[model samples]
Target: MTNSEQHTEHSEHHTEHKHIVEYGKYLFIWLGLLALTGITVSAAGINLGNWTIVLALVIASVKSLLVLSIFMHLKFEDKVFKIFVWVAMLTFAIFIFFTFLDYSFIR
Candidate 1:
């Protein structure tokens, strides 16, 4: 395609109107994150042995997902982009799982 054609196509792909997030939604998300933080802190106080780290990681993953989806605008993004992100995250998780597996065998 010519430059102008490519430019027009790209511009068309971009949303003309902005997808504005409502203030109330932002407030709710903020509150949820705050509550999760509190829970994480409370979880830290208890000793769950091997399960402690697992719980903490789970909470942290949830908090990260909230931030990533809302604050990072992943929710508004295209499916292709979201799929790429999930693939990267899955790869990272696999590496982490393997690392932990190796650590378990170390002792």
Candidate 2:
């Protein structure tokens, strides 16, 4: 092969190497999500008074994190991307908190 052709092949292999992920990791994440789903369903059958919503949201948040980090490849992304995600989440939480606060004052 010519030098240029060899260089092209090497670069392609390097790019492909970065995207390789372990199948076991995805399987474990899937199982974890399934277990969390089971908990959410079981919790729905019981009455926990005012704490039910909190419990469900907590579980949902955990599931979301797993999907985002593992499935979305955010865990392998740069620090800047992670920082942006955190900022976005923080902003969303603030908005949700204010919404609840508004509702509390209305009643």
lDDT of 1 by residue, 1-107 (tens): 11222232335456333455688988889999999999989998999898989999999999999998888877876777789999999999999999999999998
Candidate 2 lDDT over residue span 1-107, tens digit each: 11222232345334222544589999999999999999999998899988999999999999999999999988876666799999999999999999999999999
lDDT of 2 at 30: 98
For residue 89, model 1's alpha carbon misses the true position, in angstroms, by 0.8
Q: Which residue pairs in candidate 2 collide?
A: none
lDDT of each: 0.81, 0.83
Which portions of model 2 show Cα errors greater than 4 Å?
1-19
